[model samples]
Target: MKHLFGNRVIRLLLGNDLLDNIAIWIRNIAVLFLVMDKTGDDPVAVSLITVAEYAPIFLFSMIGGTLADRWEPRRTMMAGGLLSAASVAAIALAVRYGAWETVFLATAVSAIVSQFSQPSSFVIIKRHLKEEQIAAATGLGQSMAAIFLIAGPVIGTAVYARLGIEASLLLVAALFLASTLLVFWLPRVPRETDAERSGGLWSDMREGVRFVLRDARLKTLLLLFALLGIGTGLIQPLDIFIVTDRLALDKEQVQWFYLVSGVGLLGGGVLAAVTAGKTRPNGHWLVAGGLGFLAVSIVVEAWSVWVPVTLVSRFLVGIAMAFMQTALSAMMIRMIDEAYVGRINGTLAPIMTGTLLAGSALAGPLLKATSLLAVFALAAGIVAVAAFCALRLKDRPSAVEAADRA
Candidate 1:
C-alpha cells in the first residue's frame, strides 16, 4: 500500500517550500540585524523595519488578493518573484555602496512588493487541492518552513560573516528567482476581465470583509486570531533582542535559540500530522495550545536565566505555537466555503497583518516605558484573554462534518 504520506504534490511543495522559507527567513534576519547594526540599536528603527515588512499585508493585501482572484496564481507568483528579486538586488547594491538610508528604503519597498504574492499563493493552493489535503499541506509547509527557521539565520550569519551582507542579499535575490521558476509548475489562472466591471476592486474587498463579519463563527475566529497576533507579535522582536543583548550571544550563537524553537515547531508538526486523523475535536487543541504558549512565555520571562533556560522555554513555546497554528488554520478552513477559499483567506489576512503591526508599533513604546520582561508578561496576559475567548467557541456541526469527511 502506498503511504498517504508519499503524496507527490505534498513532496514537491515541501521541498520548494523549505527553500522558499529559507529565503524569507534569511531576508528577515539579515534585514533585522543589518538595520540594527547600521542604525545603532534604535528600537524605533527596528520597529519601523518590522512595520515595513508587515504593514503591506494590511494596506495592499486586499489588492493582492483581488489581483489573485483576477489573474493566474503562477503568473502572479512570477511577477511577485521578479519584483522581489529586483528589490533585494537593489538592497544588496545599496549595502555594497554604503547607502544605509537606501538600504532601509529598499528593504521596505521589497516587503511591500512581496505581499502582492501572498494572496495568489493561497488561491492557487486552494484551487488545486481538496479540503482534507489542506491541513497536511499546511503541516508540511510549516514543517519545512520551520526547518528554514532552524537553518536560515545560522547560514545567513555564516554567509554574512565570510562573504559580507551584500553576498547574502544577492543569494536571497537568486532564491526569489528560483521560487518564480518553481511556481511556473502551477496551472494557469484565467484573468478576471470583469474585475473593473464587477463592482471594482474596492467593492470586492468590502464584500470579503462583510462576509467574514456576517458569519458568526468566522468573525469570532478572526478576532481570536487578532488577539493571538497581538500577543505573539509583542514578544517576537523583544525575544530576539533579549537573546542577543541580555544573554550576551554573538550572531551565530543567537541562531541556537531559533534552532531550539524550530525543533519544537518541527516536533509539533509531526505530532499534528500523526494525530490529525486520530483527533476529532480540534477546538480543544486550539485552547490547550494557546494556554500552553502563554504559560511558556510567562515562565521564560520570569525565570529567564542562562541559555539553557531560555532555550527550554522557547522550545516549549515553539511546540505550543505549532499546535496552535495547526488548530487555528484548521478552524479557518472549516469556517469558509470551499469555493471562496481565496476570498476568505484574503479576508483573514488583514487581521493577522494588522495585529502584527499593532503589536510591533505598540511594543516599541511599551518596551521604552517598561522593562522587556514586563512587556513579555503583558503579552502573555493578552494571550490568556484570547485563549479564554477561544474556549467560548462552541464546536459546530459543520466542523465535525469537515473532520469526519477528512
Candidate 2:
C-alpha cells in the first residue's frame, strides 16, 4: 500500500478522482433538487435530468474513446476538465439570467466531456502503474467511489440547502477548474506512435470493434458487461418498490438499503486493495464468485419480506459489486494492450449502457405487466447468466506473465 501511494502519478490520479467525484455528486444532487423546486416536483422535469446526464454516453463515448487513443492522455483529460468548467460557468450565468431551464445543459456537457476524459484515465493507469500494482490501484480508486456513495449525497444536500442553486452551480464550476489544475500536474507520457495515428476515426473505431471480437477474453467480458447492465437496470428502478411493496415499509426507508450497501462496498474495496497482489491473476474467478453471490443476493432480496433480510441482502450485493468492479478493472489492465485500451473500453461501454437503458425502459412496463417478484426473478436470472459466462472464462497469461516467461 505504501509502495502504491508513493508513486507520484498514482497519487495525482487518485487526488483528481476524489475531486472529480465530489464535484459530480454535488452537481447531480444540487441540479436535481433545483429542478424539483423550479418545476414544482413534476416527474417529467425530474426525469429529463437523467436523460441529459446519460444521453451523452450513447452519443459520444465511442468517438471520445477513439480520440483518446490518438490524443495525449494528459492533455485529453485537461481539455475535458476545462471544457466542463467552461460549460458549467456558462450555465451558471444563464441560470442567473432566469433561464433556469438551461441547467440541464450543465449535466449534459459534463457527461459528454467525461466520456473523453474517463478513457484517458485508463490509459494513464496502464502507462504509469506496474502490473502487480494495477489491482491495488483499481481497488483503491473503487474505495473512493464507495466512500462517496455513502457521503456524497449528504454533502451535496448540505451545500445546496445552504447556498442554493446559483452558488451550487458556481461551486461545481470551480471544482471542475480545480480538477483541471490538478490534472495539469500529471507528468507527460509518450504519445501513440505515428502508425497508430494514421487511421481515420471511423477506421480506428472499426479496428477497435474487430480487436474485441478477436480476443476471446474480451469478447466474454463484453457479454458479461451487457448481462450485468441488464440485471442492474431492471432492479435499480425498483428499489423504492422493494421498500413499499415487499418489506411493507415507507418508500423513504430505502435510504437504509443504500447506507448498508455503501458500508459493505467500503469494506469490500479495502479488502480487495489489501489482497490485490495475490488475487490479481485470479480476477476471473473473483468476478465469477462475485457475480454468483450477487445473483443469490438478488434472489434473497426478491423473496424476503423481512426488513433485516432485505438489508443484509443489499449489503452483500454491495460487496459483490466492489469485488466484481475491482476484478474487471484488473482484468482490463492486465489483458488488453495499452494501445487498444481506449477503443476497447469505448466499444464495450455502450453495449452495457445500451442494454441498461433497454432494461430500464422495459422495467416499468414489465412490472405493470407482471409482478415485482417476476421482475426481480428475471433480473436475477440475467445476472446468473452473466455469472455462468464468467465461469467459462479461460485463464490466459497477462502481459506481465508473458514477459516473465520471455
TM-scores, in order shown? 0.79, 0.94
Question: Which residue pairs come into collision in candidate 1?
Answer: 70-192
Across 96-140, the per-residue lDDT of candidate 1 in tens digits comes to: 877866556655666666565656666655656655555566666
Candidate 1 local accuracy as lDDT? 0.68
Q: After superposition, how far is residue 82 of candidate 1 from its true place, in Å?
A: 1.9
User: Candidate 2 residues 380-403, lDDT tens each?
Assistant: 999988988997665455444356
> Lowest summed-lDDT stretch of 10 residues in model 1?
1-10
Deviation in Å, model 2, residue 273 alpha carbon = 2.3
Runs in model 2 deviating more than 4 A are 193-196, 395-406
Worst 10-residue stretch by lDDT in candidate 2? 395-404
| Best candidate, lDDT | 2
- How many Å off is the CA of 323 in candidate 2? 1.6
Against the true structure, whose TM-score is highest? Answer: 2
